[model samples]
Target chain A: MILETKNLSIGYSAKNKSKILQSSLNLKLKSGNLVSLVGPNGVGKSTLLKTLCKLIRPIEGEICIKGESLESAESNALAMVLTQGIYAHGFTVFDVVSLGRYPYTNWIGKMTAHDVQIIENAMASVHIGHLAHQSAMQLSDGEKQRMMIAKALAQETPLIILDEPTSHLDLVNKIEIIHLLHQLSRQHSKAILMVTHELDLAIQNSDEMWIMSQEGIQMGCPEDLILDGRLQRLFQSNQIVFNQDQLHFQRNHLLSKPIWMKSNSDGLAEKLSFQLLQKLGYYLEAGYKDCQLELLSNQTWQITKNNSVFQFENLAGVQDFLRNN
Target chain B: MTIRILLLSILFVVLSLLSLLTGSVWISPSEIYEALTNPQLNVVNHFIFTQLRLSKTIAAIVVGMGLPISGLMMQTLYRNPLAGPFVLGISSGASLGVALFVFAGSSLLALSPWLLSLGLGFFAILGAFLVMLLVLTVSISIRNSASLLVVGIMVGSLSTALVSVMQYYSSPQLLQRFVVWTFGSLGGIHWNEIIVMTLVVSFSIVFSFGLMKSMNALMINEDYAKGLGIKVNYLKIKMIVLSSLMAGIITAYAGPIAFIGVAIPHLARNFIHTSDHRKTLPIVLLLGSNMMLICDLISQLPGGTTVLPINSVTALFGAPIVIWIVIKNRSFLNS
Candidate 1:
């Protein structure tokens, strides 16, 4: 195991008192594993990650890194990527990544040839080699995130921890980052733990999931956690319902009357109308019998019910028609 | 990089020579060289060279190098572009020390001039250290850099107000002394004062160099620096102490010369197009000394008996550069 925490209670300490957020956290992260820590905001997901990385002292219990006590492990043995934005005004991509070699460098921080090779390899692995000469401030948010990951990779530690690494990225970039992290964990045989809100992506890519809450932390493979309904219990909310099959969330509301959705040709409008009906809690029927939503080829939607028809030019109009009816 | 260093060195030499030759006495290069090499050659020229111009030149160099380097450290520690050596009100604290000594201490204890200066230096450092402690305490609660800067400015204004009250109740002679001190003169530093300034500034600069790596890491993010095994709190305290020491001592000796601390580092970064301290430090040092020498020479108003105040000259040159930097890199303020 690269990291093992036994009965760890993590939180802040005040004058002569301690506030424990979550306790009895017994977990082991082995090499070649990608674990996603999932929890709602303020459930101590960040606290756990910080304790694991030794940023903050755990209130109780022991954390061992590579069979050694976490306090005794050299910082160079673990690499971390934080969510804070880099304000390196005039630093190039390579200059930022080379900082990861700080632990091994001399007091002056002069890079050796071996260190240079490692930095280059890290940039190449993250597919930012072309941006090595570009200033870090000039890169997009996604590119800057990759550069930070490359810095962590250059550290060459056995374990890596990232805090909300995908929070600032767009949809495609978010998937790309998760995929890259998954590949890094497997290919490099490094234990990677990330605190993430991307539940669907984490479930799809993570080898294991750490579900944190007020009760405690539950660790298992994502599929197993889902099978045991642990994931749903972790994310339980009044207005939001987690869809197990679709691996997403939907609004929970009263079901409307069934609507028979029909179209002469299946296209974007038909698919969109079906989605809208589903969102409105109206079940779709195959044949047009009682009520029907017909999508025409000329960018028009017609809703017929009880021998009356309503027309809509757009999705918003369709939503209005459904609400009125 | 070598070429840039070479050009800056040449500029430094030119400014130093100009400073030496362009004093009120108007000694030529040959005469100045003769006096520098052999003090017995010309009594008047030798006295002018050794006593006046040389000490002033050294003072300018020390203040120049010390202020900007400390300023760079401050900027990195706070991760704010507007941060400078005086951001924590160290100079105002030092000014309060000077005021208390010149106005109150002089009346309470009838001391010699030497002892008075000694007491002034001691009180200045003490006042600065006290203010540093206060700033550090406030900074612990205030996490935002911008808010901390406002706190610093408020502290400075409070100190200045207190000093003004002291001046209002002081004797005419002591008030005149304090006002002249506020004008800030490089030419007033004695050789012994320069020697002390050199020792303190050198120690602080060397300590700053030791922190260069951590400063580079800190520029990215503080938590990132900690993850890299840097003792972040220790580094922060050390930087604050060193920066305060430099700012306080310079203010005690030369009065609070403004703008160089805030302006020179920006100039260095702009020239090199890099914030890497390893690359920027040397350039900042060279440019800082060069700029100070130029400012000092300008203040001398060569060939004229009258001299302009050093602070005015520095501000005249320094303020515009800072405004230009702000305009050029407006994004930095947002960041």
Candidate 2:
């Protein structure tokens, strides 16, 4: 366990009484564990990360990293730490990443060739090497996010904390970032604690998911979350329904799919076929991509794809159409 | 190119030479050289060359270099394109200090020129220090750069008004002396004061040079500076101290020689078109020194005859160039 938040009441006040989230948060985030702190908006996820980084003074909490308390650490003498996507000043990608060594830097802030090599390596790790000379503000959204990751990597922190790491990314960008975090966790032996609202993706990609709910913080595997029927409740609203068995959201306006055409393709084909079905008003399977065309609900799509041939859901319907034609 | 720096240095040297040779007492170049080397010709020509010209010439250089570097610091600190040592009430503080002592503090202008002028320098520095301290306090307290700049200008106006009141109370003899100081003469600045000004300006220049990278970053925003782990407060405090000290001392010696401090940095920024402090600092120093020397030389060209105040000439020549820069870079200013 690189990090342990002991009774961490995190907020920004010198006095012990003005804590925003007062709870005994005890968790050991170790290497090879990708943890997502998923909660609704404005639930002190950012505050917790800020507190952990000592950017915000926690009112009544002691964040013990490795073995020492955060307050005991000297000016910027924290055991390796990085805050993701934080902008404190304008610097070149090279300049910003070089600051990860702020604690190690001398009075003159000299960067040796060895330091330059480390900076280069970090930039390459996050794939921002080409942007070395570019000003930070000029970067695209995805590039900026990657640069932040590079900065964190440059810090080489054992425990990395990110607040809303994927806040402004599209789906592809979100997945790529998650994939990068996963790689860093595994390869670098970094304990990654990311705060995000991305439920399905975070739960899927992370080795463990940390849930911040009305019930309190809980940590469990994705499977346990599904089986325990706890993951579905986080985003359940009056207009939407959650399928505990399937571990996904179902909107109220799904339509049924035709059967005979859903019997031909394999797994990848099933997804593409399901997408094609969705475009063509055909329904997809709830949990398994199994080709089962059944009357589940009126105006709701009980979709079917590829059949007994490949055992695909949406693909089976397309197969059925080929045979009929 | 580094060669351009060489060229500029050479040019500064040549100008310094021309300034030495072209004065009213036109001894031959050979005679000047002989006076520099030989003991027979040394005392008479050396007195004319060293005491009368070299000190004033060097004082002009110091004044030139000091104002712009101080201006550069002011510009970066306030994040204001127009902010400079003079515009920020520092010169007014110095002017007020000089006015108070020379005019109101005494009645004998002819008898005691040097001794009473001691208080002039001290009061000037104090005024400049007060203005800077007020600006620094307001900037930190308000947490807004623009408001701080406005407050500095307001303070300048207030100080100027107070100096006027001092002038109103002064005797005729004291008023003539005070009025002469207000005209901003580089003449009669003691060799020692120029040496002290040079040392103080060098300290400021070095102080600014040390914060080059981070100050470059500061041109963006404070938050961005923090991300790079730059302790912004320490940097700001250090910079304000250096700039105020430079402005205060220069004001003490040169009687609020205006526009060079305000204009030189803008010209440097224009020359580079980059926020790089490394490139800008040297240019500000060189160009500022050059501009000040030229302004002082032109004002003392025997045609102005009455020895026009360096402050007024600097305004006449410097105002348009700086205004042009501000208008051209208006977009940058609004940010």
Candidate 3:
């Protein structure tokens, strides 16, 4: 095991009082695995990550890394990437990556040839070696996020923890970052834990999911948690719910009756029409009902309701007709 | 980078020579050489060179190097580009000390001039140390750098307000003396006071080099620095103490010299395009030294007798450079 928390309690403490965020959590992380910490906003996910990284003190219990108590373990043994914004004013990408060698360097932070090789390898692994000499401030948000991950990788610790590493990234960048993290965990044998709100991506990519809810934390394989219906406890809102079949969250929209939709093939338009109907609180099915939709050629939509046929040249017209009628 | 350093060092040497030569009575290089070789033979030239010009030049160099280093440390500590050596009101605290000394120690003015200045230095350091303690105490509970900067501004304002109240009731003579002190002077420092400033400023600058690695990590952010195993709070306190010591000591001797502290670091960063303290430290030191010498030489008005106050000269010379850098590299401050 790379990290194990026994009866760990995390929270904030003032001079005279302490506010407990979460308590009585037993969590274990092994090398060569990617764990996603999923929770609602304000669920103390960041506080838990902070406590685990020792940025803040744990309110109770022991956190051990590699069989040594966290309180006593040297900081070089662990590495973390925080969600805090960092602006690399004048530092190059290579200079920024070289900062990860802090724990290993001497008092003056002079890097040796071995350390340089590690930084090079880290940037190459993240596919950012081409931008080594580029100013960090000029990089795109996705590139900067990768550079931050490469920093953690260069730390050479057995475990790495990231807080929302994929936030503020575009769809392609998000997928690429998650995929890179998965590869790093498996190929490098580094136990990786990340806190993220991308539930669908987490479900598809993570080896284990640590679900933080109001009750407590539930840790298990994503499939196991889904099988036991533990993911439903994440939110109390009736408008949003976990969809077991799709392995993602869905809106609990009210439906009057099922609407049958027909298409020669499910192309972008059909998928979009189906999504629009579902979003408008209409249940979609294969069989016919009082309301029916057929995609004609030339990107037109035909809707028949109550034996009345209506045609829309665009999906917007279909949306307007459905929303009003 | 090496070439830049070499160029800056060469500029520093040239500026040092110019500062030494440009005085009321122009002493030729031959006379300067003669005065150095045989002090007893050329008493007047030797006196002007070693006793007057040399001490003042050393004063300018040390203060120049000290203030920028202090400012660089504070900027990194508070993560603010506008932060300076006196941002925590060390200069104001020194002013308060000097004000109190002038009003309360009027009787001591009858004694030797050396003793009076010594007493003033004592009180100034004491006041700065008191404020340092208060800031550190407040910092223990305040977690963020922005809050600490707010606290520092408050402390500075409090000290300035107190100094104002004292200034309001003082006699004209005492007021003039205090006001003149506020205008700041590099030439007023004699050998003994220059020795103290050199020791304090050089020691602080040297000691700061030891903090370069931790400071580099801190440039990323506090949490990141802590994750690197840096004792963040301890490092902050050390930076605070070191900067306060340099700013306080220089203020006590030179009377709140301005602009160099806040401007030189920016100049160095713009010139080199890096914030790594290990590299910037030397560049800032040399750049600061060069800047102060240039300011001092300009204040003397080269070839004229009357001298402008160092404070006004720094503001006049430095404000434009800072404005240009800010406009040219708009994002360098935050970067």
Candidate 3 lDDT by residue in tens digits, B1-335: 99999998999999999888888788889999999999999999999998889998999999999999988987787666766756666677777787888877467679676777677777777777678678768766975655776887799899989988998998888888888888899986878888878988889988999999898788777888888889998998788888878888788889988778889998898889888888999999999999999988888986678999899999987788766755765554434
Error of 3 at A156 (Å): 0.7
Instruction: Give per-residue CA lDDT, model 2, range A74-112, as digits (tens).
Output: 433222223333332234677666666554566545777
Off by over 4 Å in 1: A237-249, A261-273, A285-288, A293-304, A308-325, B36-41, B107-118, B143-147, B329-335
Docking class of 3: medium
* Superposed Cα deviation of residue B264, candidate 3 (Å): 0.7
lDDT tens digits, residues A1-325, model 1? 8899888889989899898899888899999999999988898988888888778999999999989998988878799999888779889999999989999998889998999999999999899999999999899999999999999999999999999999879999999999999999989999999999998899999999998888888899999998888898876778778776577766775666788877875666676777788777898667857688887765788888898888878889889878887
Backbone clash pairs for candidate 3 read: A89-B335
Candidate that beats the other on DockQ, 2 or 3, i.e. the better one: 3
Error of 2 at B24 (Å): 4.9
lDDT of 3 by residue, A1-325 (tens): 9899999999999999999989998999999999999998887899999998998899999999999999889977788888887856778999888888998999899889999999999999999999999998889999999998998999999999999998999999999999999999989999999999988889899999999987899899998888888887666688988876567888887776688888864577777887788788888777776889989864788999999999989989999999898
Model 1 Cα interface RMS deviation (Å): 0.9
Model 2, span B202-277: residue lDDT tens: 8778777888777765665564455456778898878877887888888887777878887888777666554557
Interface RMSD (Å), every candidate: 0.9, 5.4, 1.0
lDDT of each: 0.86, 0.70, 0.86
